[model samples]
Target: MSSGTSVPSPGCALTRGRLAGVISDDAGRPPLDAARLAAADPDLLPGLHVEVLDAAPSTNALVAERAHEGAAEGLVLVAEHQTAGRGRLDRTWETPPRSALTFSVLLRPTAPTHSWPWLPLLTGYAVAKALRAAGAEAEVKWPNDVLLGQRKVSGILLERVETASGPAAVVGIGINVGMTADELPVPEAVSLAVAGVEVDRTDLLVDVLASLWEAYTTWQEGGDLAGMRLAESYAAACATLGSEVRVDLPSGEVLTGTATGIDPSGRLLVAHDGGRTAVSAGDVVHVRPV
Candidate 1:
């Protein structure tokens, strides 16, 4: 899946610096050097066309622009930092230079348009699986947050680009790697360092990419059955279930209920005093027991 500038294949004979020159985009994030990052893993997606940049306008925006410019699928846009990095609902995702992992995957799916709603949920599964593989008991929190013992560890944002070829998706992901407690902008936000877990960023990236590629391909190839399986997995891993919560809807209404499980459509199933309501989109906050 290597593209953009011609670079030697992963196993081909080339100098380290020469391999890094594959995506020497001045406007892009500094090269992450995937060769050095990935460990000897059996499952990691080999030969990923990685673009490294020191900082970027936004990984999602950059990848989307590249897709418009004819960038190929599996092209990963990674930023050492993002100047205007954003999350779902236009919230900012901050990262100091080389302090965290901020990246996006450009993918052209073979699935039908109806399957698009499942992308972000599947992305969460990928993060959870990767974190678990790293020896942390990571769990999903409804719509899109990954948590370790009730504290946030990672976030995902999936965007779609309607190309002439089809709907090209840019799945953006960020993990709090090496950021200290003092460096966090929000008091509520915590990092891997703060959580007392040390992990090689490169190794984590490899595992995440491998898991994500598998999840994406599974959904692409008649995995509607597998999607149900994933939804069940997500629900089981989700910390939101069985917790009294309030879902902050974009329409300015707070739906309060006890989160029971996730619906087949990937919406949250919350049982309120009145009845059960399925929320397609919202920010779910766990309510403190009174």
Candidate 2:
């Protein structure tokens, strides 16, 4: 894909009670423009198709259905408000209308299915890099959370689907953008506005999608973390590395240790008293060093 940039025109201001007629302090936020986004990075997503919704139950779910219907690889879905959005492990993710960037992109990779676990990690890296370029100083938390300091500003969820041709992946990305303190979903969450970084949402979306496309293409070419240098890049931007963490495994076991590194398969390696353990999946909480 060729590299180029396009700036979106200023959005039309919404009058009072214009946003779903549910008047609130944040009713004037502009909606995302599909054409403007396509124009911004025309070369990033070739044969790109986009859908911007005012609200949806879940962009990921919507895209998954489309993928099963043979949606092309470059299908992009964005929802201004996701009432029943989900994060990793089915955790509910909520944000005010147009207060965040909630979207999903469908991809059908030809790489081996074994290497699919890296898709989410690759996405987190792209988000962190894009946010940093936009002046947020963001970093990735182990697998798929984007953090500014200790608070989370974004999260990613990758869902696998079986298409007629092959297996497909839908990467859902949610970013807190213009939310105020009271509008934040949780105390541990923050938005770009709250973080004191003034940004245009459209620009942020373009940067993130472009970055993701670049990383995705690189991974598809090599089909391994080492080949794409994804492991090294993820380690460099991952805040979980070198930190004391408590991981809650799926089998109801908890392991506390110092996060040493990530292995070739993208599993988090934690060093404990007994030995180093590779955790393939879990809830990781950064803790004070014991």
Candidate 3:
């Protein structure tokens, strides 16, 4: 569970559209190549450091530890296999070795601490936007789940921690890449391969990081969603908006309603018989077409 050593990594946040026409072959899962990634965007990633690990318990946990040790920002820790990979509410998902993308990026944003709740949605927009640009039918579900068509293809977890220097965020992202139908953990899950999008993992990673860094930079600007256009952009990219939804709350309560919009604090506004309830968090969110 170490942060691992810093390598001459290749992950440069390169062109955002590199995944648009990526070619996928049946040549088995190619290892994430540092050399190829390094050549992507050297100039743009001046201080960004990317580290690829063969196996780890969890990238999010490790990155958080590093931040506590006074680690700098822009450090990406990617794991090919996480024995203990987890999503929201302690839920777990598994992908065979090298079959998916699981990584975490550390950031110490300059935005107001109160507005940091938007970090998860900001990450969802980056992922969905990047994949959609690559021809996937991607849309963000509220908070930060990414769905291809009606099935989920990606999930994000943003953990906030107080470091010796300041508050930092560890953005953990997992995307299904090469799983087959039988390999899916659930029926509602799909992979890039299952969704008919063949892309190399490195290319996809670079593409996603580019989108994320861009969105993060803008949102960190005074944390103004409207001024940065993240509010409307995320609204357009979110599939939960205007859809009937069932939320399994952490308290074992069920809330069924139409998801109206995201409020300023990044809570989902659901209109139901109980009136419009602002859901701060949920254990599970099920979306049905209106």
Candidate 4:
């Protein structure tokens, strides 16, 4: 969403130049056509509005600002480059201009407050589902990391904020699209191109957003993870389940265990030596057997 600009409604017709926001400095990265995204084929992004920006510090922060200002649900903010993109535990990642798919969507849920923790989990499922359909072998790591052949290819971060209209959730999604091996920020990260999945970023964005909207609405309507077999579907797409995991909890204590299942509330169920623990938040590492 932009300042001093009238935001268009879902069905309103607006025409924009085909590569309107692409900058020359982003040559190394693929161009994302704001026009294509805003046009967003009739069936895709049904009620959502997309605003593409050349750059931003973080789409999540920007959307949160809009949320505080009473922005409507379904407003999507997308950025070509994020100078201060963030992850779980405040971890930060940077995306070179136009090199990745980065965006945030605003949602005001009808789901019960207790069932809301499953938002990110369901988001991960949506992403992995989309990637699989896009010709990538992708699976969700526990808690919202989308992995390709054991390395992270995408991630979801959800931030909840109170707005005058109601409580709003800003769901941020980032996927490595055009980055090459040398451009990957970490050894454990991979891009679609590097992973050999050739795709148009605009098409990928549309597919991913459509999948997200479907999963989100269904899960929200169910009011709990297990209601419509959400937990079952998530466990199926989750690579973390049945793996040996080492969880670094926020208290500085580590729990090494077998990740058995995901509970309805969305906490990770770990079966460890001393006893079982339900992890609400942690850094999870899938241990490779020696």
Top candidate, metric TM-score: 4
lDDT of model 4 at position 88: 75
**Candidate number that wins on lDDT, 1 or 3:** 3
lDDT at 193 for candidate 4?
A: 90
lDDT of 3 at 151: 91
Tens-digit per-residue lDDT, 146-168, candidate 4: 99988999988898898888888
Name the lDDT value of residue 199 in candidate 4: 90
Cα lDDT of model 2 by residue, 40-66, tens digit: 545665554656666678889988998
- Model 3, position 15: C-alpha lDDT score: 16
Q: Against the true structure, what is each candidate's TM-score?
A: 0.85, 0.87, 0.87, 0.90
Candidate 3 — number of clashing residue pairs? 2
Global fold similarity of model 1 (TM-score): 0.85
Give the range of the ten consecutive residues with the poorest summed lDDT in model 1: 11-20
* 1 against 3, candidate with superior TM-score: 3
lDDT (tens digit, per residue) of candidate 3 on 1-290: 34333345354532111111223433477778766666767644546677777777788988899899988899888777766888886788667777899999999998787778888998999999989877798999887999988899999988889988999999999999888888889998999998889888888988898889888877876445353478888899999999888887756678888999988777888899979988764334443454
Give the residue spans of candidate 2 off by over 4 A: 1-26, 223-228, 282-290
**Number of clashes recorded per candidate:** 7, 0, 2, 0
Off by over 4 Å in 1: 1-7, 10-31, 37-43, 282-290
What lDDT does model 3 reach?
Answer: 0.79
Residue clash pairs of candidate 4 = none
